[model samples]
Target chain A: MSLLDIQDLTIEAKQGQGRQAIVDRVSFAVPEQNIVALVGGSGSGKTTTGLAVMRLLSPGLNIVSGRIYFEGNDVVAMPEGELRRYRGKQMAMVFQEPLYAFNPVFRVGCQIEEVLQFHTDLTKGQRQQRVDALLRQVEIKDPGRVARSYPYQLSGGLRQRAMLAQAIAANPKLVIADEPTSNLDVTVQARILTLFKKLRDDLKLTVLIITHDLGLVRSLADQVVVLSSGRVVEEGPAGEVLQHPRHVYTQQLLEAAK
Target chain B: MSKDKHFVPSPGGLRNFRKNPWAVCCLIILGVFYAGAFLADFVSPYSYQNEDRSYSYCPPMEIQFLDEEGRLARPFVYGVTISFDEFHKRNYIIDKAEKYPLKFWMKGDTYQFLGLIPSSRHLFGVDAPGRLMIWGADARGRDLFSRIVYGGRVSLSIGLLGVAISFTIGLLVGGIAGYYGGRIDDVLMRICEMFMMIPGFYLLLALRAMVPADFNSVQVYFSIVVILSFIGWASLARIIRGMCLSIREREFVLAAKVMGLSDFRIIVRHILPHTLSYSIIAIMLSIPGYILAESALSLIGLGIQDPYASWGNLLSEAMGIIQINFSPWILLPGFFIFLAVMCFNVIGDALRDCLDPHFQVDENI
Candidate 1:
């Protein structure tokens, strides 16, 4: 059975005078442990689609029509209470800007520990232990020191690693990484991509990666969904989608990615 | 793996607070003031109302003793005998043979320590009947020193009570406005603006004018506290509302909401604590303002009236030119008021620096 299923999903943002549909009748699915990439340029509803799945859309922009199913449960009809439980546990997200993703005031360890504390029945010591392990898993050097350090005290790569550690700490069933490496340098971006690949294989974790970087999809994703102006222009295996030009927008996005 | 096994202290605000010297100094000063206020009766030598008519307007006395030489020893005013100063055309004093021994923790007039424990011990000697005005006499010739010691009780208590009232109102109103935006925010903020638009001083004046003249001193005192608090809360509410509006959108707040935490918990546990540093700093800064306002009102005959000695009521006597020129000691209350305000401000600044996240501490860390 598929882990996630979205059918004919549409979303609109209420502007000053009119409602603008940002995501229109997009559809996709992720099988268990599979990696899927949602590729598009800016304003292509790539991020919005991911947010709609998480139900973390901002005020005035909402899922206008959709059926999102997760493990046979209707995600679109779930109460806010149940949706929150699903987030960071059943599913987790890593935002585009790692700097703003984690709270500046909280230490990296505490931010990760919050997830463990909320989603797991682990005691304080156990939660701390889990956080340390997660940090180490993300290739954080001196995990203890990094755990104790605030976000501002860490380097950009370290902050991104800490955020990823937090996202994975709850042992989420699906991890949605939204342009995770967009803010990193090339070297750091390569390292982060490798880390995500390792985590996905070792833990048999499903991942939904949203990005404009075709190189990332080519390297890691199993399937790809290409979107433009809120519409899915193409969908197929990641290798086929990248090799053959099925849609004009996909070709444009591929050209831009190069 | 072993390195990740141990507990590590987060290097952030807590560590910074510990290393901040100015915050430490402010804390120490504030601690001393609170200790002094709490232990005033135990630490002061005379009762709040003990009278020594002979020593009225006497400059702070220096201890004296007869040397073996038997000549008049180094500069000490002899205990004076009350008599008429015919040259000055007023009652004056003559040097007496006996010195009034300064006492400590000696039994004097009784008082309720914090309105709880009954005690008679004072830190200094009581004045002789009708005098002993270390800070000079009020209109009734009551000792200003004792009044001040006692008045500290009223002034500090009123500041605290008023702050408590203001904080409660501000938190609730601001929380609502911030959590629920749009029309609710608009309506509530409009009310806040309306309150802000009113001339505070004139409004206070009008409120004071409305108070019945027959109301007792205690009633007037409490009423003034309530009035000041009511006026003060609007500013805090507006500030907290703005803070909440921004904080409510924070990911952590949304996370809390997703966790199914009640709205009240989100406000009290999460939202409220974030505003605490600002609120506390504001409260500290506002206290002196409240004190000064109450003092001003009293100085103008609208606050605590005579027989009830606030720093303000005490300074009211100085409005007369004769009192100002001849007995400048009457202005001593004003000096103390300035000292209190300055101390609070300095302490508040220190706290702000301490609580602020930007202040660097332990650069090596």
Candidate 2:
């Protein structure tokens, strides 16, 4: 069975007098131990869809009608208290900017430990060890130094890795990364992509990567869901979809990437 | 096994604060004043109520370190002979014939130390028949230096108590309003605006007027604190609310929300802490206002009554031209007020710089 099944999910953005659908009946799924790239240009509702999967849409945006199933439970219908149990433990998210994602005041290790504290019954010592282990899992050279430093103290690549460490700290089955590699340099981006593949290979982790980078999709995604405007234009295996474009928008996106 | 061995916790702002010389200086000055306030009974030679009417309008008696032969001697203060001037005003002339040597840890007035331990020993005092008025004597012949020390307890503490009360209310009201926007924000922000619309001084006066005439000095002190805090919190609430509104939108706050941290946890631990640097500066800046407000009320005979010293009530004796002209030492309380206010502002400015994220500490550390 698929780890996450998002079916007929319609999200609306409230503007002045009327509500406008930002994600129109968006349907997608991520199988176990797979990477699904929700590819789109700016304002294509891919990020909104990702946010909806976690029920974390920004204010004035509503899930008009949707059924977001994670393992069998409907995320859209789950009560707040129960949803909290699933978040950070069963499913986690990483944002586009690691510097902005991490609280500036707290040390990065404490932030990763915050996830472990809530999700696991680990003692402080164990959590500290776990934090170091998680950082090492993301290939951080010195977990101790990176953990001790604040968000701004680290390099961009290190911050991104720290953010990934925080996401996978609780051993969440799925990680929804919203444009995770867009902010990094080409070398760092490739390294982060490789880390994601490594995570899936070693931990059997599932990822729903929301990005506009077709190159990232080609290198990392097993499945591709092309979004144009607020609707999904094409959905297929990444190799088939990239090799033979079915939709005009997909063809145009491929043309633009070339 | 040694996971936290190399974990050096980040210095939030203390390193920057310590590097600031002016802030450190101000902090020391404040420390001295606060220590004096706390140890008033033990430090002051006389209690706040102790007075000798015979020594009225006495100027600051100079402590002599040399005898008539120009040889070194113990510090001593000469007795004052009371005489009437041409206008029948009491004039105190130094009686050089009679002198009393100063002694440290001398037993003078018995009082509760920290309102618990009863003790009579003072830091310094002169023998009976010669009073050591270091800052001079007021119209009531009360030691101005001792009164200032005792009054520091009230004037200094009121600032802290008032700020604590108001900021507690301000932070919670502002945090809740800012975090939970829409209807709650509208109601709270409108209430804050309504408070802001009223002139604070007039509101203070109105609140002061409401205090029953029968309340004792302690009751009056607390009532004034409540009044001052009530007037102070509205503006702080508004400012904190504005900060919260912006901070709630920051990506870190969003990330915290996604972590399934409860709204209260997010607001308190995450959102409120972001506003702390601003709040710290605001708190430091506002303390002076509380001190000045209490002084203003007491200056007009509305605050702490006579016999019970507060810096404000102590300055009340200087309202007359004659008092200001002849006994200028009565205005010494005003100088103390200025000193406290200036120190707080200097520290506030320094703290603002220290708390700034861009404020760079030394790289060698």
Candidate 3:
């Protein structure tokens, strides 16, 4: 079995008008120590898939049929309490909107420390040490100053780096990055992608980057799953899929990018 | 003066508050009311319930630093002689010869200091047989000054206590509804609306009417606080619910969820703090509402019970224009009520402005 197996995942959205499937019968796999990119256009339900596994799906949406197995454990079948324990300690997520991803009231260091607090029994001093180290690993030059600052104080690039720091704070098995670089400029995006490659190689971290930016997948992902309107159109080695696309939808997406 | 280059000013909430002079003034006024409530025993020479039959309808005595001979002397009050007019109205004339020097820390009536320590050492008093009636006596001859002091304790406390209960419910209920939307939101919000639909005062009246009239003063005080809270929470919950509808969508709240923090923890640590900042000002604004609510109930003989002092029942005596015209000093409690309500309004408004996040941002921590 693959390290992470998502089998026939189906998610539905219930609006005032009616209930409609947002992502239907979607399936994918990621072996251990591999970087897989969930590539799709807007409204393709790439982000929803990440949320479903975390059980952090938005209010109006529901996972109707799916079984996500991480390390041979069924995530969809886990109890709420167990699911909570499984979240920060075993797996973490980095969202696209870093500005909205942080609690505005607290300092960045304090926000990062909360995950350590909830998951690990690290001493206060030890936790502070860990936060500083994490910030440095994410390539923050002034880890001390950055940690003390609030979310609104930092620039978009710095905030995204702080977000990446939070995603890796617990040193979890899998780190899900949902459209992580979609909000950054090309220069900053390149830097963040470089950081991701470094983390995956140095820590042997398993990563899942969900993005509409096909360019991001070329540099970072080992495997690519191309999705169009909630359906997977192609799946193979990242280089193979990017160089010679099979599905017409994948061809159109690549053509649009070019 | 040597200026240091590294000295960057911190622009936090306290500094922002100090920048607004109006909030400071209101804060000082509230400090006075809290002081009066805290020191009611030491400040009031006579007990709130003490009534002297002969002193009824007597005009307030004038405390003078100059003796009758015009020599500068200790503060003293002159005894007054009472006489009946043709219409059965009582009048008073200060007897210059009967000088009663004011005493401080004098042992007098017993009272529980802070309702904890037993002490009867009053702050000041006059010689026996001459009342230093600054605010004068009521129809029952009860010392109005003492009653006002005692009344401050009840009227002011109800506001804080009532708003506390109300906000606790509002934050918890509204947070849950907004966080776990859908069926939960629909049900909880329907319950909240059911509370909002009824006319507040009538609802207060209906609830207050349910309490037996025979319950003791303390019981009545608790009931009034509870009734006011019930009437107050729904409106606040509606506001909180509206805020939560948007706040739950914020990225940090989502981050907390993805981190596996329990729903309760997310609501309390992450979500509730956002509402609490707004609630702090809301609590201050609504306190006067509670004070007024208590006063209205007492005015109609449904509140705080007779002989138990509260700003409300004390003003109940001045309901008739005839009594107000005869002895305006009886309106002393009315002045306190006005001061309390007005100070709260000013303080609330000041807090709302001062605590705004965009007030003035400085780079320093």
Candidate 4:
């Protein structure tokens, strides 16, 4: 069974007196223990779709009609109380810019521990232990030192890893990464892709990556869903989709990628 | 590495403030007044209500350390004999024949120390018939100095209590309105606007007028505090709401929401705390307003009544030109009010400068 089934989802933004659909009838599924890349160019509604999956869409943006099923439960219709439980525990997200994502005032460890604190019943000592362990799992050298430093104190790569640690602290069923490698260097991006692969294989974790980077999809994604102007243009195995483009927009996107 | 400079620690931290000499001086000045107000019962020679009607409008007694033979002696003041003037106003003539020496820790009016310990030992007092009226006496023959000290308790504490009550409401209201923007924000902002629309002084007077006149001094003091606080929070809430609107858009706030922390938790922990540095500086500046509000109410006879002095009611004695001409010392409470307000403004300005750079960083975001 699919870990997450987003069927006929339509999202609208307020424009003048009428509402405009940003994501129109987009349907896709993230299978268990698989990496699904929702690939698209800018303004493709990829980020909005990712946010809708977590019900984290900003004000003025509304889910006009859709059902987001996570473990057979309709996420769009879930009550706030239960949705809160689903977030950071059953499903988690990592944003693009770790520097901005983490609270600047707090240390790396404290931010990660906040997720564990809310989702798990771990004691303070156990939570601290879990935080250090999570940091190590992200292949961060000197977990204690990195944990003690504030988000701004660390390098961009280290901050992103810390953010990833926070996302997986609750051992979530699915991790949604929104343009996670867009803000990092080429070397750091390669390492991050390797880390994502390790997370999928070792932890048996499902990941839905929202990005326009074809290179990232080629290296990391197993399944591909190509989106163009709020609609799904193509979907197939990542190798097939990248090798033989079925849609004109997909062909243009591949040309732009090169 | 250069980003480290941009993302420094707390902007309101005292590191910059301590280097500013004027800020330190203002802090010390405020400290002394607060200390005097806190220990008023023990520091003042006479109780606030202990008045000798015969000594009404008496000039300040000068303490002499040299005796008749020009030899050094304990501080003493001669007795003052009262005489009626041409206009039937009482005049005080110094009678050097009777010399009364002052003593420290002297037993005077017996009262509870801090409402915990029973004691009558005053810091300094003169013998009977020779009063130690340092700042002279008011129209009611009460020591002006002692009244100012006692009045400081009401005047200084009203500001603190009022700010505490108002800021709590302001921060919470602003945080909630800003965090969950939409219908809630519209309703709260309009309510805030309604409050801000009314002139503060008129609102203060109208609210003060609402309280029953027969309430005791304690009740009146609390009501006045509540009135000032009610008028005070509206503006602060509006400012805080603006700040939260910006802060709520910061990525960290969104991250907190994604963490599944409840709305209240996010508001208080993430959103509200980001506005704290601004709130604290604002609090320092606004305290003087509360103090002045209390004084204004008391001056108008709508605040703390007589026998229990506040700086405003104490200044009421100097309203007449004759009182100002004959016994100018009656205006001493006005001087204390000026000093307190000046000190608070100086410190608040210094804090703003110290935290100004942090605000620049925030603006960059």
Which candidate achieves the best TM-score against the true structure? 4
Residue lDDT tens for model 4, B131-205: 899889987788989999999999999999999999999998888888778899899989999999999989888
Per-residue error at A258 for model 2, in Å? Answer: 4.2
| Better structure of 2 and 3 per DockQ | 3
How do all models score by TM-score?
0.80, 0.89, 0.89, 0.92
Error of 2 at A49 (Å): 0.3
Badly placed stretches (over 4 Å) of model 1 are A116-127, A201-204, A243-245, A255-258, B1-35, B51-77, B84-90, B104-121, B126-133, B139-141, B164-180, B202-226, B239-284, B297-309, B317-327, B345-365
Candidate 4, pairs of clashing residues: none
lDDT values for all models: 0.77, 0.90, 0.87, 0.90
DockQ, all models: 0.09, 0.30, 0.37, 0.57
Candidate 3: where is the Cα deviation over 4 Å? Answer: A13-21, A122-126, A201-203, A247-258, B1-23, B85-88, B353-365
Count of steric clashes across candidates, in order: 10, 0, 1, 0
Question: Which whole-number lDDT from 0 to 100 does residue B259 have in model 1?
Answer: 35
Using lDDT as the measure, name the better of candidate 2 and candidate 3.
2
CAPRI-style quality class for the chain A–B interface of candidate 1: incorrect
lDDT per residue (tens digit) for residues B1-365 in model 1: 12221122233334455565755665676566566667777765555555554455444343555543676664333454545565653344534554455455667677788789899777766444322334555554455666776666666677788889988998888988888778988998898888789998888898888888899988999999988888888889888999999988876665444333456766876677678778878988888888888888989989987666677877888899976776677788787778777777876776666665545345578
Q: Locate the minimum summed-lDDT window of 10 residues in model 2 chain A.
A: A110-119
Q: In DockQ terms, which candidate is top?
A: 4
RMSD of each: 5.8, 4.5, 4.7, 3.0
lDDT of 3 at A87: 92
